[model samples]
Target: MKTIAILFIAFCSTISFGQTEKESDIVINNSQQDDTYRAGETIHVNAAIQGDLVTAGGKLIINDSIYEDFTAAGGELFLNDYIADDVRVAAGRITVDAEIGDDLVVFAGEVILTENAVVHGNLKCFAGNIEIHGDVMGNLDIKGADILIDGTVKETSKIVGEDITIGSNAKFHKEVQYWSSEGQMDFKDSLVNTEAYFDEDLGEEKSELSLISLGIASFSLWIFYVLSAFLVILVLHALFKNAFSNAVEGLQNNLLKSFGYGLIYLLGIPLLIVLALVVIIGIPIGLFITTIFIFSLLFGHLIAALLLVYYYKQKKEKDWGFWNITFLALGIAIILRLLTIIPFLGILLSVIILSITYGALTLNVIHSKKQFVKT
Candidate 1:
């Protein structure tokens, strides 16, 4: 289960990378793509986007309008434009300086909503430090280390943090509830609409229901992953059936070499990335390699399963056809996921097998490319 969670996080990282940081300093006049997939070191926009805006980078500054939803993740994100739909973000530092017609959800180290910021719907924030000096017409939910609200919230608010502060101009026209560790609740009466509720042990309390909910959530997430892997297998099989078959064959023929190389590659990459970071010129190369590594982690398990299925069929009386590969792949995926429920051994085996598969796939691609060059 933990393994699956890690893969999911890695996969989401890839998606986030594709959306943000992938495209740097892109400017759109009045055009719209079906969807925005961009990542780069820094992003600066002075135009409008029609479709869903997805971006990641070191820094993002938008000064235009988005017709659809906006999603971004990076080191720093600053939006001074109008978003027609919801805004979802995960970043190191984020600041919204414009209006969002829908919800604004952010997970960041530090989040600030400047006075120019306005949210027509709910504002949900999870951060290390959050200060809202803007206007939210809907409910506000904040979970962080420190929170300061000087904004006007027309609806209720729920806050959970270590330190919480409400500015004199902060307006909560409805009910306000908070959970804080400091237990300091001295505020002017005019700023709060109703008597606020503060409890030190509010969110920290654990109950049987909470455990059951967590169990259910974990099971659901595992099932979702199985389904996603099956989908990926089907798509890859359909598009690259021959290539996948060759990769499976390569893994079977060179299992020991692949495993050794996988171990070395896994351990060596971080060191290389660190060295690259020390040399600013190698930053792009480092990021590209990191992206490839993330993709390998995502596809490694499925590829290993495929290779396993192929290895078993080799010992069988008859091999399955292309059409049957999907079913075979799905069966293997289910068994592997079920094995994840066991204690540490199951996940450990998965890691080793996936690493071997990643190495095999890398070698197979290199060999193919070399053959093409030779021809």
Candidate 2:
């Protein structure tokens, strides 16, 4: 717990590193830096980095090489250089025309690996459109709407998509597993020196579900959560329509206050529960506190779903219509659940999200009480 707290604090402190407008629009050319961490509207790096590079902005373009890990988030990212370590990025549009010495983790709307790109380690991507014209030395795990592979893979490749096209020039030294539509497997005979498995009836099944359950399990957890959240929202929207709208309005109206309350709830609850457990006479109380804490944790996703539903629906109009909150919640859940793939800076990310959800819920409850008192 102490370690988790320290890590969370450290992560929080790093959030504002070079976040100023002037400092963010950096274009480093013919320079060397030990480590780089910046947040801006636009970031451009053309110099070598000896250590890790962490940045976030509206637009990020890296034209120099890095000796260590590279992490970034932005509206769009373009990597035109090499990295000696792993690369993790979240962006709207991602274009990699360089080399990754290690693994690659990406969540984006569009991912394009130019012919010059290469990954020496594993590759994982969640995107709407993926076009790979490079080489992957390790396994490739990808989920997208459309995937076009004209690359070479030394290891296995797994893909989940609506439409998957393996260019005639694409080569895989090992097996390939994919899930696609019913009639998309029209190039079976053209595949050479490779075994392919299609999850649906697009082609013959190379391997059964039992063989790939682990891989599926790892990625499908988010999908399941999303479906479940959507279902719950449908019911909640129908029954507690006003409450959902109130929650959303409360959050939007009092972002800072809600976040503050959320922070308190997260840290204070655990301490209170532990203190209650210190006395024999308070055992039942401790148990009750523990239960409530656990319940809060369990309901975290629901709160998120509600928040999302409320925001999405309210944005359609100022007065806000309560009828379609369920569908709006589904849209929000889709986006939140998709972000579950990122795991590098673990607890801090979780804490940030939890705070927002808890805060929104608490703020709504407080406001609801004021209205009750007025009545």
Candidate 3:
């Protein structure tokens, strides 16, 4: 599950890069496009997209139509338009008043499908609270804490929740299966055209042994991550010794400057990739950038460890050779890995270290390019 989550974050990061520090906090899209990618504090889409639409923001409002899939992650999301294909979203709160041509998949805290909404395909959701008063032409699969369904499910329905209520207006054309701690719920015969099933054991908690096994698995995965990261850093040092040295020198010379540049690269590159993805011809470039960005994020901490070791060596006036530096970097990486176990502080420290490391690296790269041009 952790690995899956990590991969999901990496994938989202690739597409969620948005405007630079100087750009507006809000993004407004009013033009047509083959594929659109946007990220900001707030996003408003009022155009007809010929292809897909992908966005990440704090608040997102879509008042137009999408010809293909629509994927988004944000705080508050409102869809008041038409989606030609599937809709996948993860957010805090989601309200849908549009027409979905395909499936609707959502992971949210609160979800509402107003009466004006119509889904041509299945509805799959995991939320804290869900209210569906619209029409679903396909099956309904939902899991939540509180659920109220007054909608029409044309096919089978499976719902799992703490509190489930089927409104008087609810109509099920097929079988409905539900699981809750309170047991099977009583539904009016008129509301269902088929049967209903309740599996009591499905909602039960896992056994102690299962939890222990899960803990062991998670620990093993962490160990693997640490070892792999160490190996990757060693390989990077071996293959790009000169380039790495130059970046360390740059960091030693101007720590603040490198950090500023790193901050820009961290934020600006994503925005550039988003823009590139908006154009059909620039799709390749966007994908390439995404790959490199993911790599940088994955190995960022190890890189930071290396930078720390080099900085320490410089401060101590030590002339450590390649092998000694390698050992020092390994030790630093282990210490960093351990420090990251302190909850919030660990995460904050990791981000700070990553920023510094990447900043130095980006500075060196730019300098190298300039020197190449001059030569």
Provide the overall lDDT of each model, using Cα atoms, as 2-decimal numbers: 0.69, 0.68, 0.74
Q: How close is candidate 3 to the true structure, as a TM-score?
A: 0.54
TM-score computed on alpha carbons, candidate 1: 0.59
Candidate closer to the true structure by TM-score (higher is better), 2 or 3: 3
lDDT of 3 by residue, 1-375 (tens): 222223433443432222112224554556666788666556888788889987766668998899999988766799999999999887768999999999999867789999999999999987778999999999999877789999889999888888888898889899887887678888775255487788764465212223331113367655645544544454444434455566777888889988788788788989999999999999998987777776676567677777787778777879898658766887787787677657899887866777788788777767766876799
Reference-based TM-score of each model: 0.59, 0.51, 0.54
Per-residue lDDT value at 272 in model 2:
85
The segments of candidate 3 whose C-alpha lies over 4 angstroms from its true place after superposition are 1-29, 205-375
Q: Is candidate 1 or candidate 3 better by TM-score?
A: 1
Positional deviation of 138 in candidate 1, in angstroms? 0.4
Instruction: Sort the candidates on TM-score, descending order.
Output: 1, 3, 2
Give the winner by TM-score.
1
Candidate 1 deviant stretches above 4 angstroms? 1-25, 33-35, 39-41, 205-258, 261-339, 353-375
Which of the two candidates, 2 or 3, achieves a greater lDDT against the reference? 3
User: Any runs in candidate 2 off by more than 4 Å, and if so which?
Assistant: 1-24, 188-190, 200-375
Quote model 2's TM-score. Answer: 0.51
Pairs that collide in candidate 3 are 262-359
Q: Which tens-of-lDDT digit does each residue in 288-348 have in candidate 1?
A: 6676665565566676677667667664634687547666877886676566446898768
